[model samples]
Target: MKRQIITFATLIAVVMGVGFSGCTKLTDFEDTNVNPYASTIPVTQNLLTGALRWLPATVNSDVGAIYAQHIGEVQYTDASRFLGINFAYDDFYRGPLLNLQKIIDFNSNPETAPTVVGGGSNANQLAVARILKAYFFFHITNRWGDVPYSEALQQSDNLTPKFDRQQDIYTDLFKELKEAVDQFDSGAPVEGDIFLNGNPDRWKKFANSLRLIMALRLSKADPATGKVEFMDAKSDGVIMTDAESFRYQHLAETANQNAWYARYLTRFDFAISEPFLDYLKSVNDPRIPALADKPTDGNANYVGMKFGLANTTGIGNNSISYIGSGLREQDSPELIISAAHVLFTLAEGEARGWNAAGTPDQVAAAQYYVEGIRESMKQFGTYDATSFAAYIAQPEVAYTPADAIRKISYQRWIALYLNGYEAWMEWRRTGFPILDPGPSPLSIDGEIPRRQAYTTLERDLNLGNYNAVLQSQGPDEVNTRIWIDKP
Candidate 1:
């Protein structure tokens, strides 16, 4: 009986030991890694779209184009419905500054390669990601002067990244765009490039055009370098060529619908300002009728109000369409930056005296101005082509070199249409075509803000670096000048 008891005890001990060992092994496995309840790739793509979706799509021109010198229609300060939009009326910073935060994040990830996709798998989607990154970054640092760089995209890893000098950032931007453009040299058809329909050659053109913009942004900073880049890239068409433009055609489907169009249905929608309409009228710029469809037509030179103030000012709060006899058009996603603008850049560059390479500044400027004008005349909501042509053919509509630059900036601003902040940025940089500061009691530190205070959220999260930038500039806001911008 004693031996049998001993044997039973030994068996029980072994079984318990085995069970304990198995539990420990399971614990070790659990401690070491993860199953990733979410797929990293899809998660990454969602992150990418999140960044893009944040970019400026016309919310409501009525509120946006207050300083619009191109679409010279509408009159009065809109209620502050477009505070974020008017805050950067030039379309310079907000969209690029905000959305780029995401793009830079995706590009930094080694797992993803960048390319624009029409119908490619996720692996190839990063191309559009890269292109937009460069495009938007160019817009940001150029307007805001010194902005957070090197670590702007390190949201997951580090929150506080210091601002880099605009000069250094521009240098990096040029190099990055050059590198980005070169990546498309694999000339074989890419799987999912949406902007170029998977055409590698077209992607190459976009990269070069982007390079042109980068080069030009440096014009105020380093003219020699800018000229060199301008001349060098002349061999290839600037980004505006039909073969190499970067544009995402909008569709009727809501999934790919325009941002500004959705705003019309919301409480936030407001009318265009008079100041902008007056500017366009002053120049007799033809793009106005196509951009905003006012209910009335009497004030030939009516300009719109500053974006957000109309509601606050109580100007036409109940009026559905405020502009006097302006055309009312359906809303759509206007190009934030265009392919045709690429050619316009070349034209402007030529006018700036860098014309010897291919097209002289004078003629290139004229031709592109005309081409850009024609393209701009295309309707978004509703427009009259004959009226636009009449506006274009007016005696005041001469296409001088200065006029070319003005036209380029104007068209670029109008192309941005409801993308108001960029228009504000261009006005800040080029003093374009010129605009009157609309009714703003708070007037961002006694001046139309050059740069907005970095989001307090960003400051709160990245206090160390954010405070450092503020220390140098003092009170970050619309007054702060971005890197390349020479306000």
Candidate 2:
């Protein structure tokens, strides 16, 4: 009787399974048949690659380049015109930042700790995540001062986080970098790292180098504090050569191609700017051919388009020079920070009597400054000893105490070509090689933007906090200076 009853129930279950397939919820059955490969939580190692890939794409593109005058828009030139910008901070919060936060969460959780640290130490993985978090936050905060820092990424719990002052944010970033470096465990190497290849020493150098960058940014606002941070980071050992520079080695595949090549090459929507081209041409800069291509109109040399022009009017498609193959090729590397940048930073510190190498003299500044230029040249694969010798001997390029700052700033500018955000930041700080974007129909006060305006999305979605930040920081305008830019 029991066997017969079990057979009858089995038959009923089979009949119901077929008969109620359309009406019953599939997920009810799926609850008991979950895929083993699928999990609610992500594997920590898998989260890092996406963040690293996206960082360069964000850093090396669009508004920053336009502001720095590395590339001019061939079509609509509103962005290059110093018009009001609506930078969507929402994308950042939802994207790379989320991924980085995941890595931190997975490694820090005791329940998921072993799985997350499968090939690495819990401390090392967490440290790497923290360092990257500091980096992304640094970029975000630098772009828009007094952003939602402390309480951001809270998701549903804290949708309305208060904007943290840029000063406080900087302080926190310094702390993160210091702590992350200190926490690196050589015994348990980091795995699945695309940036430093799990090398703790390099990561340590990177942390110190980033601190140097932050320190120099405070030069105008707080010289005393800036000097202290600069000296401390340099003493801890910052990036010293091209071999140690932070860069992304892009692959030739469609998915892993360089961002610029993907954006500009096939479309031909961007061209070298007149200011940049003229500057290089004026100096007989050897890097010109490496930086830009000859015009397709048979000019046999580079010719720049006027930046922020209304349209590509009075110019044929073939007249303007495209970004050169070396930089705009599929496999071109995206440089995050170069040895040149560090050397130049140190050179600037030395010139200003901050905690940098050598005496606070012109000779000391010149030494680092010249090496920065050399390293930059080598970085571009354009270094010829004979040419470099003649190039530096020029009175304009040669260093003198009266022109020390200008030379350093200008060379730093040159080395930072295509690395637009850094160039724009330096321009904001030092105001050297004074750029002229000229008049534009869309410009406010006929001046280049001091800062990007908060996005419309922020105003719409997080209006209360957005309004608070606007009221406290300044008007929602690009002309307003951030804390770092102010006295």
Candidate 3:
């Protein structure tokens, strides 16, 4: 009877499963009713695979990077700055916001399992999807502030789902991640588990590291809550070393390649920024040559011009001013999270006098950051090589906790180069290696934008919920503080 009840509930969920017409019955895709199918699991796996495409897809390209460079400035505009694609506010409405909506609608229901080789009845695959779901939602809240939650992926059935406040969403995200982590173990091969290649232990590491990030993010908004999550993750297998890690690898192909390949190979659109170049020049970072351009006319032997701007525009401000060289043959894979980043996170936690997972804040972080620099270099690999530390030993190198968490953050920022979306995020999280003031007509704040404005499409697609979010957030302006903007 209990099992029947559960099945009934699932059916109700399916019947009103928003956009999931394909998931109305488990048997619709697989014969989970009797003998479960292992091959069906990839349906959900496909979702995870597709999601990998996004990090490279939406991040700051040469054109987008220009706006990102000045997101700190206020006058930001699409017409004047040539930043309409990344900054004019349509990208979210059309790209991430919409695609992510599709991802969630699928993960939230059974219809959209990855089209992996295995069957869909595998509990392991579901576990992975749930965790990814949590990560996806976390990204959304981080960027958009409060958003539609409880009723969020319900489609027509949930058209009026009330928007959950950012705080509440954070509350649920940690809980779900915790529950999802608990559900995982060294289980049998689940279908389509490509991120870890079906390795439960690796997935555990991802969960723990992410939990640490979530804890750190909320330390200010809710310190006690943050510590609890922190304690639990440390006890779990957080990526303390290279053994357990996660990175989004890219390819040269359009189907499933690294984003950098697209930005550097396909578009030929971007160049290294002066600010980014100047920062590296100060440290004489060894990775610069591998990562950027070399020209006597540039900030360093290598400097690229701002993308999307043509020097031939005959406009005084035309980018044709010749900034120098650009990134490289292509960029590297997008790092989702790394041991080095985890170490720096701990360092910052300790500097702030918070409890670290197991090791002393300073000791663990120092060792981690040093090793992280090395690993980062490894992440890039020979041509694939990245992270240059030979230069870190210079006078400005070898920083200890005395120099503070800023050192760790600055390193993280450097590690995140080319991967500017994350670089920008880390800057906001730690506020280090302050970017020098630059000029951009597109800035919305006297400085660059602190957050993206709520897109106009939401006003139509999810108006009631969108309005609820706006009511709490106020006008959907770029400067509204989500949960963590303590300052």
Candidate 4:
């Protein structure tokens, strides 16, 4: 599949006369299907469509879900046990990032900009490209740390790019997102925006919301900067309603259906983790039924599978709860950033005494906290006035001044369910919910991995840059914490 994508990308490069050298030639497809009379001019809309399609992998990562302890392995357990490392990020660069770069370059060039105007206004297209580029880079840096930044996607000009410091990458990302939002003009909205449907207002809100969340990620490493950025983004505007959430809506067709639906068709390798389910059950979370299904053991119980267990002698589909049917449906939407996430960040900001509306107080923090939870419940279709009120009234769920950060972090984790990468990052940042590595842990030093190792391709192909990063950013191991994950 990856080879096919690279082939398609190479074809695009050939047609457009852009020398994209990010991907290696895996196979010769010269004899394969080729339209000799096809248009040589690049279409920005098609490139944008390809870019958007690659985004689901960023949010739908099974390994990330495992790391967050949101799901457990019912059969194969290597990922849960933290066995895999050195995951490749080439596909991201060779695919979506490359496409986005093309969009920006084509729109920026005066000669080509007019040709691609059918895709959208040149300004709008460039703005969307920049915004998405930042978004993808944000995830990539969070996952791998110290990745290629300034010199990345230079086509044939610089194949072996230098790995920038995570701090610098983040700084530039904030600038990029803010600029992208501000770059939008009163022109036609961007074409092929499957996520926001070419809605500039929603795009602005999404960009600001992402900036807000990224600001919060700097809480530990640089709290002063975090607070300033958080307030600025909040004041600018953000996702404040469920309708404005950033999501990737899947189709009911086999080609673009929900990934979970395809996974469950023949495999039953994942189940709700015992730790996560127990926490939900303990707090009487109304989203429990919405998160998992009852076991088919004839007892009709929502039994969660113990995570990272080496000895899964008897566990099967009949014994543990599967993910909820709604979430696994063919057309189920995959949420990227939501109002609940932004609200939770605001709650945290308030707790930290960073506020734009007014001086922060426990009262405002509590109010934001409750609203965050309410928004999350509503997001999951489990909100009811009585149940919500009762749920928040619980001693564990209720907001208190002393436990404000912890309470807010816990609820945020709940709200971030299924978004494993974000959830894991939050856990690393806040040290909330106190996740314990299970008995049979297999990661470096038997600890939960903090970051993934650089791919072997990096060491072999980009050897100098790879070695330099290892010297500056600690060893290329899962335990090497990223800059933002500082203690």
Candidate 5:
């Protein structure tokens, strides 16, 4: 599949001269399928469409779910056990990043800029591509500390790019985000945006919201820098309401349906994890029924399978609760970021005395916390004013100044239901609502992994640079903490 996408991209470059400079000679004139009038330049819309496909798909259904304890595998539990996990980074560079880079390249050219952009101005199209590139790089660096940044994607200039430090990468990400958002022009609206429908203002909000999240990641290690970035991001405008949430609408067709639905249709092999179920049940969370299924063994309560279980020994499809209908629907929306997340991040920032759209106060923090919860429910179609009021009135859910962080972190964990990678990353950063991997023989050092191991290909093909990172970033093991995960 990846090969096919790359091949198609190559054909586009050959026929239209889209990705890079210079036109290709039509040596294969015998090919009747080639369009004679095809412009010898790539269209920005096509590249934009191809690039957006990877964003939600990678986040929503990746292996990070197992690590986050959002779901337990009924079979093939090796991933849950944190054994022999090595990440492949090649697809990302060759796929979405490749397309996005092509868009930027075509639009950056003075001669081809006007025709390549189609509906949008060259500046707006370039800004959109730059913003997406920053996001893609952010996602990559967050997972595996230092990576190829400055020298990456320069096939001609440098193939084996040296790994940039995480600190340096974060600095560049902030700069890229800010510059990209500022570059949006009213000359013409962006074309072929799958998430925001070409709204540049919404794109600005998404960028600021992403910066807000990224800034908070440095709270523990570098509080001063975190506070500055958080305040700056908040002032720039962020996603503060459900209406502005970043999401991708899935199609009803089998070819382009929700990734989760496609996976479930092929096999019934996952269940809500025991820890996840217990937390929601403990709080009598109103969102539970919408999040997980009711047990099928004549039990009225939801029963999740234990996390880290070696195999599907005692578990049966009818005995355990699977994910609910909201997630499995054919045309379900893939939520990339939500108002709930933004609110929760604001709540945390306020608690830490960082300016986050409101004055820092215990009362303000509590209000934001409650609103975050409500937003999560509203976004998932489970909001009920009366029930939500009752839920918040509980002693456990009530907002108190002393237990503010705990309450915020715990609810944030619950709010991040299907976004397992972010949930796990948050858990690593905050260490709140402590998770337990139930008694399983397949434990790796009796704990969840801090980071995924580097790809075997990187270790073999890029041995020198790979070893340098390993030496600086600790052993090439899952438990080796990333740079941001400082104690």
Candidate 6:
């Protein structure tokens, strides 16, 4: 198999460049004409493979993990302390989004459609591209709130595209996902789908599962819409088994190995956060050993580092627990979405009175809650019938109708483990299992950040659009809440 290899260094360079540069505009006649040396037509399969390579996954050392308090720095603690705020979304647009756009454009155009059939049937390719585009946009909008959307990727047609409201972006996302699922034809399935092995049925399940998850995000902002979308997606069918979970399997080769594996090769800066470990230990969670490694202090202790400390100079490298070895293997798989996540979402939906049928709301919610935990335990390789039964029998783990949401949220947080960004987003939305900043907090207002600040490139290159978004979305600060994040 020919895999597209994208290194972290290359991604960093792409992100550092100006945003909107992903689109190309021909300013000169020479540029407008295709060069004989270059292939004007893109191979749709290659494009799809390239785009999939850019899909984001949770990495323990990333700041998202720190914000979620999943992992903390054992050495430099700047990220956990919130010293860095501005983040770039350009690499996403430049890499995956651009490739996906090209696939859509090619398959949609009559001239190019026939040529790319080898990759898949025109309708199938377009369906996959649209679904992926929606998924990528969902991630983007969630992080920075209002971002370039409707008029984006216009190449030279519009360099300074206006930022769309997060609400509108989400509305379109739901529509796009639904439409994309409908667009799939009983034709050749997409050939370069590394996530689902080009299975159209699996793709449908993925799209519906994503919609189910996205619908729940509007619980606070738009319950009516949320319930409708959630039920509709549930009716459409979602990932019901662990085998159907959306995962990205990495090869042992350096070109496409796990990012965490690469980081651990020569560095040991990240360790499990004290709060997370302490919580897991307090609840006697069975997944603890599978989640972290015992410290190297010649003892069997699984110590974690205090999150967001100002100075970790005194912390010994061997004193803190590293990420579990099972997770950092070169060929370890990374999850995009899991059955456990879907089960937890179902639990929340039931608790919120969005249950379609089955047992009563509380009863169904409890069933889903327990199953969700089981799925998560199975996912992390910690499931044992006896231990699981004992674990759930505990008073704290037992589900209570009044405290259902809080309980579900805590389990969801644990289930989301390494998926730091999603976990952090859920925390912002639900405020469960409350997280506190370290003693030496540096974020705006000394509170956890609600959103990432716009990158400096946006301010410098797209000043007009940047300023306009700030006016409507509130000041470009870490503390400002996005539209869906209602207080």
Question: Please, what is the TM-score per model?
Answer: 0.71, 0.91, 0.74, 0.93, 0.91, 0.92
Cα deviation of 390, candidate 3, in Å: 5.3
For model 1, residues 1-487, the per-residue Cα lDDT tens digits are 0111223546766676676685746555553445567443423444444445544443234333443332222233322421341123223233333444444444455554343222243333445556667666665554455666666654334445677877777777767666655554443343423345555566566667767766766666687788888777776656543323344555566676654455444443445555555556677665565545554434443335444343344444443234322222232444545655565566677778775654455876777676655555543322367765676676556576545666677666655555555566566767775654444534555445555445455455557766777776556665556654653
**Which has the greatest lDDT?**
4
The CA-based lDDT of model 2 is what? 0.81
How would you encode candidate 5's per-residue C-alpha lDDT over 1-487 as one tens digit per residue? 1222335555665766443344255454346466878877677787898889888755785477777888888877877777655787777887788888878888888887877767488888888888898888888877888887787776545646778888888888899899999999878887888867888998899899999999999977677888899999999898877877888888999866887888888797788888889989998999988889887789887998787777677677888899887887888987888889999999988988897444458877888899999999988889999999999999999988888888898888878788888888898899887887556634357678887777787776667888888788888777788888878
Task: Report, for all candidates in order, the number of backbone clashes.
Answer: 89, 0, 53, 0, 0, 0
Off by over 4 Å in 2: 1-33, 36-41, 356-359
* Model 6 agreement with the true structure over 120-236: per-residue lDDT tens digits: 999999989999999988988888999999888765567678899999999999999999999999899888888778888888999999999999999888988988999999999
- Name the TM-score of candidate 5: 0.91
Name the runs in model 4 displaced over 4 angstroms: 1-36, 356-360
lDDT of 3: 0.56
* Candidate 5, residue 398: how far the Cα is off, in Å: 1.3
On lDDT, who's better, 3 or 4? 4
lDDT of each: 0.53, 0.81, 0.56, 0.87, 0.81, 0.86
Better of 2 and 6 by lDDT: 6
User: Which of 1 and 3 is ahead in TM-score?
Assistant: 3
Q: Following a full C-alpha superposition, what root-mean-square deviation does model 2 have from the true structure?
A: 8.3
Candidate 4 Cα lDDT to native = 0.87
lDDT winner between 1 and 2, please give it: 2
Per-residue lDDT for 132 in model 4?
92
